[model samples]
Target: MSNSPTPSLVKNGKEDFHHVEGLTSPNSHINVGDDYANNVNAKIRNPLLGISKPDLLAQVTAFCKEHDLEDKTSVFRKGSLLAQHPESFEDIEELDEEDKITIREEKTHKWRLPWALYYTVAICSLGSAIQGWDNTGANGANLSFPKEFGIENNTWLVGFVNAAPGISGLMSTWVADPMNNWVGRRGVIFITGLFVIFPVLGQAFTHNWWSLLICRLLMGFGMGIKTTTIPIMTSEIVPAAIRGGLVMSFQLFVAFGILVGFCSNLVFYRIGPLAWRFQLAAAFAPAVPIVILIWFCPESPRWLLKKHRYKDSFRSFCRLRNSEVIAARDLYYAHCQFVEEEEAFKGTTLAQRAKEIFTIPRIRRANLGGAIVMVAQQFSGINIMSFYSSTIFKEAGSNTLETLLASFGFGLVNFIFAFPAIWTIDTFGRRNLLLFTFPNMAWCLVAAGCCFLIPAENSARLPLIAFFVYLFTALYSPGIGPVPNVYASECFPLSHREIGVAFSIFINNTLSSILGLTFPSILSGMGPTGAFGFYAGLNMVAFVIIFFFLPETKQRTLEELDYIFGVPTRRHAAYQTRTWLPWFIKRYILFQSNARLEPLYHLEGLSGGTTVEVMAIH
Candidate 1:
């Protein structure tokens, strides 16, 4: 046997071997005759014929020149064009003061990249806490201020209280995206931090609602940008293995902020008239430390990379990863892969990309399910408890202290529960959890809503049902809260993940805004029972949809997620049957540890055509 006869057998090779994309041995049977060209297009279009392996490239080039296309220059990229690599990382370097910094950032970072990214995760959580605080605290203050300000029926103030941050956030998010592009993530935050004080001081220094509302809106907008940006930067800076867990810190902080706000309200409720203003002003307190500390924080390498300042991007990546050269390489390659994908589809509009997401069956299914999950969490009547828990408890017969204590309890529940979701999300898997108890959550809501329907004289059961609502809140902290963000964050092509999160969160907040705006009015028109029952029905529908449609995405890498969702057929087909997920494993997991290795590729039966046949060995 001529040891290597032409067209050696990969599809039906000597051995029926299956391997990942970057690592599979190049097909040895390719003919070196004047039959193909050696160029980028040729290589990409016909990678199956072995354009990558060095042994084949020279032979392929001879054939290419014979066909008049070989002399073209080729940019060598030792990685796939997807958002991640099978066995690679980003390029990073350590600083001169390496010993002190490396000991701190490398052995362990104080906060994970996501939590550390923008002080605003802490700030936004606090802002949201303040929203809850003001909503809750303002009620407590009114007990004293009702006689002080000589006003009654403070319900309209509720909408202003909640809507203020949201309205400002909407504007700030739009501006934040642009500013980060203009200056840097750090600079935009620093400058935005400056504006933060103007509102805090305005609220503390001034005495009117108009002044307060103006400051709240401005603070809300700034926090909105921070809320959105923190997740984006965290996802970029951290490793995928812990991405969800790290992001949970931001949500966790929000809960803490709420507790802080509530306690501040209670402490000040006993004080002079100036206390409410101080509480509002206290919201700005985080900005001061953020300004002090963030100057030491490095800009997001990914953001810097986006600016086309590669060196800065590289250095930023180095700092975030604790200066581990191995980790640095993985980061570099993954970043390169992401940047390539981003560049490949750079100019698609928000609307157009959003359409592609829901229209493509694979991506659409994931996106729709995630959106429903996010909305369902709200519809489970949790927001009723969250937004109006103090009122609910009071209606159920708690005094002011008891209600504030209840408010504190909800914050405590959120903080406590957020942890398990981070711990178990990747383990339980997204689809599996959603399939199991999500409907149960809806059922619990139904029961709680019905309780509200009973006559107030039947107050005995209201507390029980209200407690059930609190139980629902606890159920939510871990599973529902983190999973939707995790899945939505993972669902789209790497090229569009950021925008996807933006669009989804945008929908989330918009729906929240509408609900926040209307829930009080709805509560006024219909009793609490009727209001939450409607939401319960919505959750029931959401549950049915999730059970049938959502696919599990826990272990999959972002790069594979791109392939798993980008192509209409392959997207769905990824889960339709089983093929070796070596590409996914290689790109996402092993690519870092084994840098010398190549990623695997397979047509996976119809990986080329649309049939379900496999290549068998001789």
Candidate 2:
């Protein structure tokens, strides 16, 4: 019960050094394993910490000159000191009231950001909308496109046409890395915008199954690249405190796009033989805003820094952040971390980095974590709803108009429920949300599937099925919906970010392609009850894997995560199984007030200078 720091202990013939516990009290001791200790000491310290003011000033001056930032020397000097000793900012008498006030406001008014930042996020979010719109557009068109193309009875071909985007996405996602390295995030997005537009419009004019498949395949190429880049762009620019909620805006807009697509389906439902054309063509509307407005936003600073364009990176940071001081602080800190990351993979080719994603322990762990979440998103069965809700409703015995209406209701519920994740994804934490929602989703799927067995004469049968399906969407919108992209985007080091994200998306789209290709058969062969029940079982499988493998990653900086993921998988899984599960049972299930839980990761610099203990309880 003492509040004093514990003496350093020796383990594995090495002295275990102490870090100031930032999560609880400053005086508590964090007893970490050898892996955590080695990873933390090697990668997680601030280089500027403990340097004399004169030496720090000299380094800042050299950085400014080297980066062509001489005009901001004063700001850099202050920012470097602030970054070095964030805990004692008030003690640093050199900072003016304005600077202190700005730092204070960061916590108080996290959402009150600059117009350029908002505009940039808005454009990126609009790009995300294109994805959702594409999905539901295909959903509505599914009812007519197969018949129009004379493939309505060919179940396999129908599935392939619907899955064209995902199949092409699998091929194109790997290209995201080189493209990102070559043209920067904005360029990749802009080019992908063209793919989103023309090919999507081409969907409206295709006369046969092969032509329609070709157009959708082209659209998938753009989707693969855009999906890979936009999340990375948003994750790189946003502040870490609000990163989850903001990056999750990607899913929110995807939900919004789904809603709009459903509305378009209903609006054009009466167009005689051509209703599917307008539904498919309307997906291009969201893409137009992305192409026109992307240039107006600043490029991602992290991307700039990756290319050694430090001056431009600083400017981009300024536009993204509220003040030059905060911008410089972030830029310099990121630069320090980037230097460490670069040293780890210096002179390596893209292939080498890709290899490291599997070979290096730290990078491999991140890769696993990101991949699990991405796979989980697919297995959650949300996309089945997005891609075939109208078909699903029709299968449930509704007329054509009633089917569209029910699909719209699902879209509306999906979009409306996504709003809660904006607040929850950060505060509730990523891993906790997944653990809480997966079981509920599993049961919802089961219940919806069970409703199909009810007598057709029973009036409540259809309504009950819709209710359970809507409930599943409600749970998914906040948990798995937003977490995957946000979690995957931030887990990898900046050096491996593009490739890492690309690999994760590759898994996502590949599985999506498989699901799309096979689901029609799954429905017809197994029927709705068996298909839903099969996916419901997957929900539990996903939940178990997540519980054992995924570590909580909320509120940690991108750099700080190097240590969190560095913890060996066996070690983290053991902690969760042995320590966390017992505590959860005692505290929540048994209502024990005296239950004490152990923390998994101890991280610093979450807010200014404070260290936080990342507990499994979230």
* lDDT of candidate 2 at residue 274, scale 0 to 100: 91
Query: Each prediction's Cα lDDT score?
Result: 0.52, 0.84
Instruction: Show where candidate 2 strays beyond 4 Å.
Output: 1-47, 604-614
Q: What is the lDDT of candidate 1?
A: 0.52
Q: Can you write out model 1's per-residue Cα lDDT over 380-452, one digit (the tens) per residue?
A: 5555555566666666556767776776677677667777766666556665566555676777777777777
Of the candidates shown, which would achieve the greatest TM-score relative to the real structure? Answer: 2
**What is candidate 1's CA lDDT for residue 192?**
63
Q: In lDDT terms, which candidate is top?
A: 2
Clashing pairs in 2: 22-611, 22-612, 23-611, 23-612, 23-613
